[model samples]
Target: MGMTIALDAMGGDRAPGIVVDGAALALRERPDLRFLLIGDRARIEPLLVRHRRLSAAVELVHTSEAVAADAKPSLALRQGRQSSMRLAIDAVKDGRAAAAVSAGNTGALMAMSKFVLKTLPGIDRPAIAAVVPARRRPVVMLDLGANVDCTAQHLFEFAVMGEAYARAALGVDRPSVGLLNVGTEDIKGHEAVRDAAALIRDSGLGIDYRGFVEGTDIPEGTVDVVVTDGFTGNVALKVAEGAVRLMASSLGDAFRASLRAKLGYLFVSPALRALRQRFDPRLYNGAMFVGLAGIVVKSHGGTDAIGFSHAIGSAVRLVEEGTNDRITAEMRKIASPGPQLVAASS
Candidate 1:
């Protein structure tokens, strides 16, 4: 009776091994959580046998085909009808599972999910949303790589969805929403962002609308939800990742540059490790495909079992919080007439 998550056992780079290990890790944390593992039984069964706790918690549905990492989205859609990824999503659509999680090809997963689950009412396109570390805590960012060119209306809808997700997943009671732009000033952004800001401000969706935010604002925690087109969002996401990697590399170089520095590192090793854990992407592995009729979390394909476990935990949290219902209710409110807005202060 607790939340059930459907997993595509053959979706990730490591496939059944990491999938089974991740499920075991998740099961150890949440005993009541159940899983419907869809993949080749030959590969998965052996792995599951090693974890007795996970063996009892899963219901396997074997599938012979799997979407290839390099396959085009269209190709995947045509040939992946019986694939593990598709079947896992099917479980969510069929009401047999509360959510679906995959570490498969992004395009294939998005295509199959849209085709099977369809979009929610009033949502023209589904956006990929993820939580990123911020100054205070993690901020919810949407349109990570879903639609490259989003209209003003699409950005507005993203704000509504992101705000709801922040409340549900991040436990932020009243999250401030910011439109990602070149500058925070009202006159600085292009027509799309400027227009979206006006819509968010006047429409009164109840979320705290902080007009505009620059790239620096992201890590500064200027707002709780940062909304932008997929192109910009994706680029920003990658740049942030590269920056983290560069810092780590530079730190390593500095430590090895001098004998004194190497000795200094010994004293600071514990603090450095703590800092690394704070910024580890594994802590935020799941990226939710928002605007869908059902919940679907996309994990990083190359992540290890620990990262995959975090992804499963994210799916469970979304289900337990009724995130989809909150999105639907907010969408309905935004669709209705009047200068209506909810009651959170800006």
Candidate 2:
């Protein structure tokens, strides 16, 4: 049977319209794909009438309510039982859909998904893992604002999950894993990071556990997966985003400075276009909430139809690759007795 994805149709900035458009775009690429679009039917039906193929593939689930963009996670969880975001997540939990895709409030989606689907058997907490552009290829980084405070074991688990993700998503046979730290030295970073490194190295998990990696290593692609706590990982992600924007803005300013610069831009335009395509953030719009029992992909709230389609594609890839099954099996390996985990000094 073809995959059915649950979409929080009213969750994004351009609701119903862009969501419908994105679904159409995804369907064009994968004709077998079907959608369970959860939102206000009145607003969504008009948009669907425009796309004949998508109209045929989509099943609308009506809900008047939607979680507000600025709503707190706690408040949304308490009050948003009937909201589109919550209902879409519920679809995954109830097996109405293979996975749920939402361009909603990140915290609310995470909170609802966890409450409904719960975590996998051995997972303590779910982490947000996403692919980021790197020198050689995209790198998988985790805990992207999911758990601000993570223990050594949490970070260790993140590494395991990340490794599996890299293999499934990036098609790498043996992806190298690294713990993010201020320096690559053993004594660097706080207690949790140090302990996590020790656990990965000594756990007999068969991971390519590269000891430690600095911030530069992320863009340099020093490791296939970089694991860190939510606070640091989120900060690093934001900084990289800001830097990309700054570069784009600065280049535009330079290109428009004078007629000579304009001429120069034309000469280099092809190379620049290639560069832009390689580093385009829209291509990597989805962040998978790994360790969840059912698949839940978080799309960027401000992304366009194409970006949202990419996010939907991400959910499809995970479902096809059986990512969650791989994670569950790997977790079982660590739980069994092979090599004792190295305890950190207090």
Candidate 3:
């Protein structure tokens, strides 16, 4: 069957418009794909009606709920039952969709996903996974925010699942893995890091535990997989993304001020375009919440049509590769007890 992406049209900061436009773009580009944009028909029908080219390509699902970006997670999930996030995920859980994508509040989506689809067997919690461009293959970082407070054993489990992600997504043989830490040295991290390192060190799971890595290493594209608790990992991911935008914007403002600089920019404009594409958050939007029973992707909150297209494209690839099914089997394989933690957080 052709892959279908269920998008939460009312989820992002720019609702139906950006979501709908992106779906239209994807539908136009990929002839083998279809999208079910979940939102309010009353609000979206006119938007669709105006675009004859897009009107025929997209289908709308009337979602009566709204989960504002800053709303409390608990309240958002409880009150926003008709939310596009919930409805879109429902499409996946009920087999109406192969995968679902959203740009809603992270915590709220995580909470609702647990409630609607639940986790795979032997998987304690779902970890958000992001694909970061690297020198070789894209590095996949997990636990972006599914579990803020995690145990040492949980971190080890993350490594296992992360490896599965790299294998399924990156096609690496034994995806080199490492734990994000305060320092790259062996004695750098908290108890959880030390414990996870030991567990993976002697693991018979055929994974390459490549020691420790730092925040700077993320942009350097040094590791195939970087594992950390959501609290720490998420901060690093945001900081890195913000840094890219800050530097790019700063450089843009600098080069546009002078005639000499403007002339110089023309010479390097092509290079700059290449670099911008590499750092574009749109290119990074298709992050999966690993350990879940089905595929769920989270896109940037501020994404427009361009970014949304990329996210939907990613959902198609994930579904085609059967990534979630492979991840679930991996979690079941290492369900046994591993090394013990010495009462510490990573």
Candidate 4:
């Protein structure tokens, strides 16, 4: 049977409509793919009728409740059993779908997904990993707001998952992994980061362990996989996003500064549009929750149909490539006796 993706049809800020439309967009790209749209039948059915092509490939599961945007994770965990988010996750856990996609409350989605699918064996906690467009090639960074506090061990696991993700998702043969820190030298970061770096360096886990990378190294494509705790990774991701937006905003202002500038805008518009596409967040909307037994992709809640389609595309990629299995294979390479941290010479 063709792969099916379970979707929370009423999860996002502009849901049901946007979700349906996004599914239609995805179907245009992958006609063999199928969808199980779980949400209000009344809201979803009407939209499905508008896209005859998508309607044939989709199956709607009526769900009356939805996890509220402001709902606390704990509240959703207890009260959202019948919600669209939970049901979508259930579809994946039940073997009815290959993966699940949601643009819902982040905390609630994570809570419910963990409760339903459970973490893969050997994983302490799931981490959010995403593809980043680096100068040389796409880079994979992990722990983007999944676990606010992570141990040195967690960072090591992130590296393992990230290396596999780079191979499966980005087609990197042997991805170079780096620990994000204040400086590249040994003894530059806190105990957790320093320890993680040392372990990776000496573990001989078949990973191309690059010593350490600073914040500036991310966009520079200094490493193929950047591993960090959730707190730092989230902050760095946000900063990079903000910087891109600022560049676009400044360009718009410069183009509208004067009549002469307007003339120049006409000549520069095409180049700027190309650059915008390269940095478009929608192209990289899907955030994969790694280290889970089942696949779950989180889309930005405020994203449009185009962005949501990309999230679904990401889910498709993970399912097709057996990303979880790849991660497991990589984890198996860690030596039975954990390697001791070897301090590098100053």
Candidate 5:
């Protein structure tokens, strides 16, 4: 028997259609996978007819309601009980699926997953972790818009979860972890970061803890995992993404500036194409809500079928790799009596 994943089929910018199409794409790659697609029967059924294999592998659960793109997290939580997004998460909570994937409202998805799945034993809050392109390899950064404000202990927990994530999802063995800050110096950041660093260092968690890393270090691949509060992580993510867009745009304009430049593009086109592929946002669509008891992947809302398929792929890997198990085991180590985590002074 294969692992089943619950999909919020009515949840994206282009609902039902892209959801079904993405599932079809994912099914081709992982034949053993099964799906519990939750959405409107009328819209989803027509798309399924085109992919007989997927239709066979899927069990559709009908729901006409869906959380709006702009819906507040609290409103969605209170009123979206019958929404496809909520129902799909419900499947995970009810043991009907091994994981849940959504291209829905980010806040709503995070809110619902936390409410339904709860956090792992040692975790106070679940953090949203995603892979970002780096110089050497992709880095896993967490607390991505999940909790804007966090305590030192919370950041410490994020490091533990992030290290486990790198090992499970990125195939990194003994991944190096870092606390994001203004400077590499221990005294530079606010008390929370300094304390989190101290906790990770003294806790004897066996994590390869790199003291501090700046925002520039993220793209430079200074560490395998970057841990921060959601507010900073979210801001850094947007800044990096915006920078990539700006660079791409500038390159395009330069290439079209003159006939000479256009001719020059022919020679660099292959290399540029390779670079584009390496940094394509679609390739890194899935953001895992780490620390949750059950797997939940949030796909980019505007992503196409290919991107959504990658998000599904992320869910498959997380389940197959037993990411939560790794987290639990690591957390247990900290809970044991060897070296207690030091409390940071407020």
Candidate 6:
């Protein structure tokens, strides 16, 4: 009866095993939450048995088919409606689960979600959102591969969605937003961003549109949200990850360079590890496909139990906060303006 997360049991690279393990942890840790594991019952039940404590908190819904990791999403969906991903999505639509979580093929998950839940009344397409840790409050970033290319309008829409999310998660009233661009100048970007910036600046959408912010400023915490298209957003996400890894590796090498440095490392190793974990991109792996009709979180495909738990926890928070109602309200104000849409409907 409380918020339930319907997990795609046969998802990600690890499938039923790793996902089940995370579900076990979440159930043991959170008393109010429940789980519906959607996949082949034979495979999932045995896995759940191994974690006997989770037996009471989890239910299995059998789904025979599976959409493989690298298969074409649309094609997979058409041929594999009985797969775990589709079944899990259906649970949300059928009012059985408050949310759904999957680490399956990204395109397949999105495609099935778009079909099963459809878009919200005012949203044209949904975007993926990630919360990035900053020097201060975490920054909400989107569209993390929701749409490969996006219009300025789409970016603007993402801004609204990001603000709504930040407000709920960070308790940020009137969160300041920055458009991701090569430069901060108003005239510095392609026509899309320039036009989007003008619209966000003037629209008075209850979110603070703080002009443009570049990639370098993402971790600065000067801004609460960064808005961009999926192409740039995905690249930024990977770059931040790679940078962190390289920095950590370099630090290890430097620490072992000399006896004095080794002594220093012994003194500072704890602090350094803490800092590394704090900035680790892997720590912020789960992201919501924002602007959807229901709460759907997509996790990193290659994730361990720790990373997977983040996605489950995010789904719980999003569900409790009435994400759907807030999303619907935001989209209504900016419902794709066009006489053609109105005329077509008429």
Please report how far candidate 4 places residue 339 from its true position, in Å: 14
Tens-digit lDDT track for model 1 on 1-346? 5778999999889987888899999998999999999999989988987889888889999988999999999999999999999999999999999999999999999999999999888888999999999888888998899999889999998998898888876988899999999987778878998998988887756779978888998888788999999999999999999998998999899999999999999999999999989989999899999999999999999998999999999998888888778878877876875532333332
Per-candidate local distance difference test: 0.91, 0.93, 0.81, 0.90, 0.93, 0.83
Residue pairs with backbone overlap in model 1:
204-341, 206-342
TM-score winner, 2 or 4: 2
Clashes of 4: 0
Candidate 6 residue pairs that clash: none
Candidate 2 local lDDT, residue 228 = 94
Quote each prediction's TM-score.
0.96, 0.96, 0.89, 0.95, 0.96, 0.92
Residue 97 of model 3, lDDT score: 89
Report the candidate with higher TM-score, 1 versus 4. 1
What overall lDDT, based on C-alpha atoms, would model 1 receive against the true structure? 0.91
Pick by lDDT: 3 or 5, better one = 5
Q: Which residue pairs clash in candidate 5? A: none
Off by over 4 Å in 3: 50-58, 135-137, 171-173, 336-346
RMSD in order of candidates: 3.4, 3.0, 4.7, 3.8, 3.0, 3.6
Q: Please count the clashing residue pairs in each candidate, in the order shown.
A: 2, 0, 0, 0, 0, 0
Q: Name the runs in model 5 displaced over 4 angstroms.
A: 339-346
Cα lDDT of model 4 by residue, 190-235, tens digit: 9999999877876677789978999988999999999999999999
lDDT of 3: 0.81
- Which of 4 and 6 is ahead in TM-score? 4
